[model samples]
Target: MPVTDVTTDPENLTMTIVADFAAPVERVWSAYSDPRQLERFWGPPGWPATFTAWDHTVGGRAYYSLTGPRGERSSGSWEFLSIDAPHSFEVLDSFVDDEGKPLEGFAPMRMKLSFTPTAEGTRMIGESHFDSVEALNQVVAMGVIEGTKMAMAQLDAVLQDLREFAQGKGTQVELLDDTHVRITRLVEGPRELVWRAYNEEELMRQWMLGPEGWEMTECVIATEPGQQHRTSWAPVGDTPGEPFGFEGEVLLVDAPRRAVTTERMQGTDGPETLNDLNLYEEDGATLITVLIEYPDKETRDMILATGMAEGMEASYTRLEHEVLAPAERS
Candidate 1:
């Protein structure tokens, strides 16, 4: 058990938990920053969590749900107030509904999490402040303390397998649901640089091309919400492939961290997909996660069958070798 102590104060209307881990502060922080590793231990035992949206930035929000053995779901959300990488973050935590809205009559709690280096490894401190004594007691009666211990106990196994979450794992895909798919790739670069590579036309042209025989013919970026963006690619020289393109309207844009867009074939009126892009950096490497929501399961299956993951891996390899490495050298 990593949890050393759990305490509650009626006078202060706060609850605190202290846990220690046998890993560096950065590694421990990465577990929380990346939704994949986070979901592994965020819920207790049979109640595994699934993060549908994660925006790891100040003023951002994260939405997740825990599924019970009987298929029942409990939803929650966190509104980030402040963040200092590898150190501390503060959020307003609330019990939400299926649609992610806070449940009526349940007040949100202000929670602060801090990570520090210890002689053995890292010590994590979590403090949750409630609005009233009833609020604190209510959650305690709901088994918050016991549930938390069970959750943190699972973290040790996650921290031990470091390589699985680190860089050099090529582009990976996760079938999140019938219509949702998540694609992740860790590139050796800073978050800002990687974000720019996706937004800046000149930089994108250098590494966004998939495989060896293609070239980007046109690139249009959307800098803000509601704006449209388009990108087209064509095979070069003797390469045998037809030209193709994608066009989308930007739904949300939190520069250098997250972006949400609706994408579809350039000239097709068939269907559209929502693409939610997120970037998080740990130890100088950026983890790029794109959660795509297709119109249906058929569309999701059709797209994955087209070797999309392979093409994405090829592009990510080029991104690190051609764009990020050169930027680091310069």
Candidate 2:
């Protein structure tokens, strides 16, 4: 199938599966975030899964049943430990009885899903951790590996549906002046919702990711003037290096309208930038505009040479697919 590798660690009792998708990371993440989309690929070819309950928040639980061709049914449930949308999440997965209670004979395992952007598309890593090697081998004997591969292969079709839902021209970037750049986009959602997405720390993390295989490690936001706003990001996997961070102070705060801030790159000798963000209602959509003014032309050109605009485009695409599209649907 689309899976590139599947491995089991004997000492740790962990099974890891790696697969690549030919769609953006946001589009691929939709398969897991959207229940209807998840049902299309969460089971093997002959066994289709149907969810009875799906609660995605921390401590939330999900219940589903898989029906075989011959009418046989198997069910299970998941208890969410953590959820980081468009990035990764962890859950305690277990077999369940018809009454939705965990089966005493089965061993529960912790499962984690990580979505990382790639040049081609998204790289998804699925890992299952068991308490003992015997428990891991038991599930392997139950054909878990083959079933997982088949289920993941169905993601292509789900991605096609997501692409259709997320259709658009994409965001645009303009150099306003030698020391300033403006990024704009028409997001499909309510003005208030669009405003909230940018200001809220949880929502910002979903779409503000800068590049492939990188994620925000910390996010702190205060919407009041004179308050502090801080954030940091780093490579998703085991990459050696310190995280890149930004420290800023809110200069202006206008609810559902505009905001102004001054930000500086952490651990670098760089000039502080004045960031002006404004939002407007355009037709039935929200048009967002961001202006970043650097201290000098030399600093602006240097950042541009690093391909910041192209990376911003990728991030805004995620805004369209993950935040705006889902908010509109709901």
Candidate 3:
């Protein structure tokens, strides 16, 4: 429900929030109380979180830290007021110091988190009460609601992904530019076969998913920053429509190291992503780097939410086994 009311007494302040997760109470509760599952969506945008302590008892405490841009951390804690397994709980929570001491000037809070089972999924109610009306007013101005939801959203998506993975569907990925993700493997094949996996038509066709309808009809590869790669992308198998073509320019490429950079052009569309593909050779193996860039925070978040990087890794894993491995064995 929309924040129905905003009121404060000299000694108290409260705010309420509601969200529906597309899962059962057991799933939702596990996501909430399980420390591993809790950290995924636990902070405001641009901040990552880690749960340090969680003891779900009447007097027990839960603690977590939100790490900011430069690795600085703001820690918060929750003292359990009540906990009813898989249903509802209440806690006295606050932002505190490393030693678990209350910040000298900040007021602590009593928050209620309730999970109600619904036909569609689980309905969550998170209500927070501050120590004073003045404190509540300050938090409202500071956007506690948004912050809570951000944290909750992360939890929701993380659980949904775990559910998917358990069912053999897929994993979820969150892309952060500053975080370097290196995926490497030794390919027994020669550089030429590796290069073909990247640039050759017939060889590409062997593994390019075109027969099943997922390959690009044409790629204009100029092999340099100023050059262009003219290409046309087709839909995957069973897709009902003609192919859509695109032109992409080679933004950078180092043939010796087997890397290529391209700027997507007309007929090409993607998730506002600036993507770079690099291949490094050592002892005849290619270390590939799929570098992706975003213009700003909004798009970074969009790309992150899509889990494209994770999907890329999965598909690449399949390619390495089915495509490259065979060529080497041949």
Top candidate, metric TM-score: 1
> What are the runs in model 3 whose C-alpha is more than 4 Å off?
1-12, 161-330
Could you tell me every candidate's TM-score relative to the true structure? 0.60, 0.49, 0.52
Clashes counted in candidate 1 amount to: 0
lDDT of 3: 0.60
**RMSD, every candidate, angstroms:** 10.2, 22.3, 11.8
Distance from true location, Cα of 171 in model 2, Å? 37
Q: Which scores better on TM-score, 1 or 2? A: 1
| Tens-digit lDDT track of model 2 for 1-330 | 579999999798899999998988888877897777787679865466779898989999999997653346889999999999889999999999889988886899999999999999999999999989888999999999989887787677567643243236466666655776767666766678788887898899999887677899889987988798988889878754557888888877657866778888976556888777766554457667677788999988887787777777788778878898987787
lDDT of each: 0.87, 0.80, 0.60
lDDT of 1 at 159: 86
Task: Check candidate 1 and list the clashing pairs.
Answer: none
**Local error of candidate 2 at residue 87 (angstroms):** 0.4
lDDT of 1 by residue, 19-72 (tens): 999999999999988998998789875466889999999999999998653346
Assess the local accuracy of residue 146 in candidate 1 as a C-alpha lDDT between 0 and 100.
89
Lowest lDDT 10-residue stretch of candidate 3: 163-172
